[model samples]
Target: MRAYRYLDFITALFVVVLIVSNIASTKVVLLGPFTFDGGTILFPLAYIFGDVLTEVYGYKRSRRVIWTGFFLLILATLTFGIVNALPTPPDQQSTAQAFSAILGLVPRIVLASLVAYWVGEFVNSYVLAKLKIATQGRWLWTRTLGSTLIAQGLDTGLFLLIAFYGVWDNALLWTVFVSNYVFKVGVEALFTPLTYAVVGFLKRAEREDYYDRDTNFNPFAVR
Candidate 1:
C-alpha cells in the first residue's frame, strides 16, 4: 500500500503527541464538575485516528502507526525515568520537583500502560476493519462504537489491574475499572456522529475507501 505523504506526517505528529500526553497525563485537573486527565483529550483523538487508519487505509498502515506509538511510549517512559534518576543541582530543586511531578511514573505503571495500549489499539483497528468488511461498509457507527466498546473495556480493565490491582482495594479497583471503561467508551459514543462526519470527509477528501479484502492481518509484520 502506498502512503499518502500527509497521512504519514500526521501519524508521526500523532505519536509525538501520544508520548507527551502520556507524561502530561500524570497531572489531573477539574473539567467543571468532573476530574479529567490531560491525556483524555488527545488519547481519544488517537483512537479516532486509529479508526480512520484502519477504516480508510487498512490494518497494515494502522499497525505501523500503532507500533510507532508503542515504541515512542517506551522511549518517553525511559527518558523520564533516566532524567528523574539523575541528581539535581542545588538551584534546580524546583525544576526537579516540577519534572518529578509531571514526568515521573513508576516503571511498572509505565509497563502496564504500554502493554495495555499496544493490545487495545491493535484490537480496535482489527475489529473495526473486519467489521467494515463484514458489514459491506455499512453501519459505520455500529462498527466504530462496537469495536471501541470492546477494545476500551479490555484496555481499562487490563491497565487498572496491572497498574493498581493490589494498591487499591478490590472494590475501588472495580469502581475505577467500571468508571474508566464507561468514560472512555462514553467519550467515543458521544463522538459517534463526529466519527461519521470525519470518516465521510476523509474518504471524500482523500478519495480512498479501503475494504481490506486482501490484508495480511498479521500483527507482527510491520509491512
Candidate 2:
C-alpha cells in the first residue's frame, strides 16, 4: 500500500459528513415549497467526495473509505442509542428528552439508511470506475452526473420506502422521495465544476489518475 498526501484527510471528511448527515436527518425542514430532511443540504457532498475519491484514487481505495464510513455510522448510531437510553440526572430530564428527540435512533430508519448508503455508495463508485474505463477518462462530467443519477435514485427510493412507507401518507412519502432525489442529483450537477477542480488538484498533487480496468467491484471485499 502506498501513502497519498490527502487520502486520510479526504476519508475523514467523508466519514464526518456521513455521521453529521445522519444526525441532521432527524428533522424535516421546509424550504418554501420544497420539504426535505436537514441532511439533504449536505449529504450530497458525500457523493461528490465519493466521485473525487474514485476519480483520483480508484475504486479499491474508495471502497475502503466507504466501509470506514459504514462502520463509523454504526458506531455513532449505537452510541446515540445507548446514551439516549441512559437515565438522566434529577434536573436534566428535560434536556435528556430534548436530546433524545433529536438524536434518538429509530431502528427501521437506521436500518434503511445504513443499507441504502452501503448500496448507493458502492454503486456510485463502481459506475464511475467502469465509466472511467469506457470513456477512456475523456469526459468527467458524464461519469459524475450519470453515476449520481443511478446512485441517488437507489438511495432515495430504498430509504423512503423502508423508513417511511406506511408511516407517512402516501402522497407525502412520494413527495419526499421526489424532492430528495431531485435535490441530490441537482446538487451533484451543480457541483460538477467544483468536482472537476478538486479531482484535478488531487490527481496532480498525488500524481494519480486511476482507472479500474482490472479491478474487482465487490462491495464487501476490504482489500
Candidate 3:
C-alpha cells in the first residue's frame, strides 16, 4: 500500500468524530426549532470525510477507514460501559451517578450507531465512487451531494428508529428524523466548496484521484 502524508490524519479525525458523536448523542437538544441529539452537529462531517476519502483514495481505502472508525467506536462504547459498571468510590459516587446518567444510553446508541454507520458509510462511499466513474470525474458537487442524499437518509432514519423508537414519543422521533436528515444533507451541501477544496488539494498533493474501476465494492473485503 502506498503511504500518503494525510491519510493517517484523516483517519484519526474520522475515528474521533465517530466516537465523540456517539457519546454526545446521549443528549437531546433543542436548538431553536431544530430538535436533535448533540452529536448531529458533528456527525455530518463523517459523511463529508467519507466523500473526500472515496473521491481521493477510492472506496477500498475508505472502507478500511470506515471499519477503523466503526471498531474504535465500539471499543470506546465498551469502555464506557465497563467503566460505568465498575464500583464507584464513595467520595466520587455523585460524579459516577452523573456519568451513568449521561452515558447509560450508550449501549443502545452505539448499537444504532454501528449499524447505521456501517451501512450508511459504505453506501456513501460506493455511490460517490460510482458517480465519479459515471461523470468521468466531473461535477464533484453532484457526487458528494448525491451520495449524501441517499446515505444520510438511511443513517438518520435507522439511527433514530433504532436508538429512540420506544424511548421517545413518535412525534419526537419523527421530528428528530426530519431535523437530523435535513441538517446532515444540508451540511454536506453547505460544505461543497470545502469538500471541493480538500478533494482537489488531496488529489493534487497525493497525486491520487482514485476511481472504482474494477475495484471490489464488498464491505467485508480485507484487501
Candidate 4:
C-alpha cells in the first residue's frame, strides 16, 4: 500500500462515490442538443482512477479498494431500505415523501448497478494491469482505451438490460446503450492527455511506478 503513497485510501473513497452516484442517475440529461447521463461523466473518471491505481500501484491493492466499494454500496442500500421502512409520524408526511424520493432505489435497478459495476471495474483494472506488464509499460493509451471499451461494454450492456429491458422500446433502449457507451469511452479517450499528465505527475511525485509482476489476482483480501 505504501508503494504508491496514499493512492489506495483515495481510491477506496472514489469507488464508493462512483457506486452511489451511478445508482442515483441512470437517465440522460441534455446539455443543449448534446445528450449525456450525469453518471457517464463521473463513471468514466472512476475507470481513470482505477487505471492509475492498478497501473502504478499494482492489481492486488486495487482489488481491495474495488471490493471495499462494493461492500460499502451494499451496506448503504441495506441501511437506507431499513430506515425507509421504519414507522414515520403522520405529521411528517412531507418529510417521508422527500425521504422516499431521495433514498428510494428499486431493488432491481440497484441489483443491476451492483452487478454491472462489480464486473466492469474489475475488468478495467485487471486488463490495465496485465497490459502494463505485457507491453513492458509502453503504449499507455492503448490499455486505457481498450480496457474501457471492454469494461464499459459489459457495464452498459448489463446495466441497460437489467435496469430497462422491458421498460422501454427497443429503439430507446439501444439508444441509451449506445449513448452511454459512446459517452463513457469518449470521456476516457478525450481525457487521454490528462490521464497521461496525471500518471506522469503521480509517478514522479510519488516516486513509484509499481509493477504487479507477482500479484495475486484474487478480488478479495486486502494487501
Highest-TM-score candidate: 2
For model 2, what is the error of residue 105's alpha carbon versus the real structure, in angstroms, after optimal superposition? 1.3
Q: Give all candidates' CA lDDT scores.
A: 0.79, 0.94, 0.91, 0.81
Local accuracy of candidate 4 as per-residue lDDT tens digits, 1-223: 3655668566765766686576556556865444555677678778888887777677876787788888888888888788889989999988988887777778887888899989999999888988898899999999899889999999889888898899878888887788888888988999999989988888888887878788887776555
lDDT (tens digit, per residue) of candidate 2 on 1-223: 7899999999999999999999999999987667888999999999999999999999999999999999999999999999999999989999998999999879999999999999999999999999999999999999999999999999989988899898999999989988898899989999999999999999999999998988988887756
- What are the clash counts of all predictions, listed in order? 0, 0, 0, 0
Candidate 1's error at 94, in angstroms?
A: 2.8
lDDT, residue 163, model 1 = 79
- What residue pairs are clashing in model 4? none
Query: Candidate 3: global Cα-lDDT?
Result: 0.91
Worst 10 residues of 2 by lDDT: 214-223
Query: What shift in Å separates residue 217 of candidate 1 from its native position after superposition?
Result: 1.6
Which of the two, 1 or 4, has more TM-score? 1
Q: Candidate 2's C-alpha lDDT?
A: 0.94
Local error of candidate 3 at residue 17 (angstroms): 0.9
The C-alpha TM-scores of every prediction are 0.90, 0.98, 0.97, 0.89
The local lDDT score (0 to 100) that residue 208 gets in candidate 3 is: 96
Over 4 Å off, model 2: none
Q: Count steric clashes of candidate 1.
A: 0
